[model samples]
Target: MFRSRTKDGQAVTKVTEAEPQQIRDPQAPKGRPTPKRSDALAQRRTLAKPPANRKEAAKRAREARRADMQRQRQALAGGDERYLPARDQGPVRRYARDFVDAKWSVAEFFLPIAVLILILSIVPSPQFKNIAFVMWIGVIATIVIDSFAMSFRLKKGLAERFPDENRRGAVFYAFMRTLQMRRMRLPKPQVARGERP
Candidate 1:
């Protein structure tokens, strides 16, 4: 069904119905209304206020920087001179030297020595007291001797290979290489646990 309309001798049929007007309730709650300008102004005022205590923030930042610098200095000086002799060798050679010099390889070789030391240190048995002391001395001596020999060997090797290269750069590179462990992270074939093939 449609309503017919006439204008300037032309007739048109309209099928759509007009939407009903919205009815306002006089007794409706005021909470449903849009926010006023005062609310918006208050929000802007809060946002525009300066942050509290700039001095404390600056002091904290300076302290953090100072602590960081101190740590860096300590790390730089702690082992630099001690490791200088082996600073330019290849990764494998350097690691091998380090392992031997530190007498860590001895521990690897003599598992029983470590176990004995552990047992002696922890157990209160009187019979094994002397044995523990002997093992401790032997381990300590081995580590010291190995470290000195390895350092000497490393220095000799570096001198032979890099006769003209700047020793400082070589040393720095070697130290960084060893400390950062860049070589160990390289992708390579590895023996997986329980793998037979």
Candidate 2:
């Protein structure tokens, strides 16, 4: 123990002690109220509990999946850029799709014409089969020429519009999209046929 002298020159023993509990000032800003421990424990227990049964759990999972798909479909239909798939996202892709969709392409009719040719060739008549073969050749040539022209135009336009965008695979994407009928195209065409991009 150590002795200390005060102003009066009296000896006194000094004792060190911990600080007393602090009194909160009523005028001071009070932050958010502290949550109860019981409330926190209840929330944790509720989260830890499993569903009533396996069937119920499965049903909930299925419903969640359906909801997610529904949201995706809505986003796709609306062309909400954020939720679009990688292949269809970005302003450049949208521009390319619009450019392809706005014009008519000979390839759009290729499927039906090919089917027609097949039916004609199956008639078992040599003359008819020869005619069908010739028609098929013409169809192929026409589509090839038209597709080449369309692809050229699309590439040129994309280059002009989005000089900084990566052109790789974009041409093929536009070409494939151009092959489908305008009405049947997915992410449904934003512009009508003949509409400018």
Summed backbone clashes in each candidate are 1, 0
TM-scores of the candidates are: 0.33, 0.67
In candidate 2, list every pair of residues with a backbone clash: none
Provide the global lDDT of candidate 2 against the true structure.
0.83
Provide the global lDDT of candidate 1 against the true structure: 0.50
Residue clash pairs of candidate 1? 101-147
- List the candidate 2 regions with Cα displacement exceeding 4 Å: 1-61
**Local distance difference test scores for all models:** 0.50, 0.83
User: Per-residue lDDT of 37-79 in model 2, one digit per residue for the tens?
Assistant: 9988976775698789999789868877887778677766766
Q: How close to the true structure is residue 95 of candidate 1, measured as C-alpha lDDT?
A: 38
Task: Give model 1 RMSD, 1 decimal.
Answer: 22.2
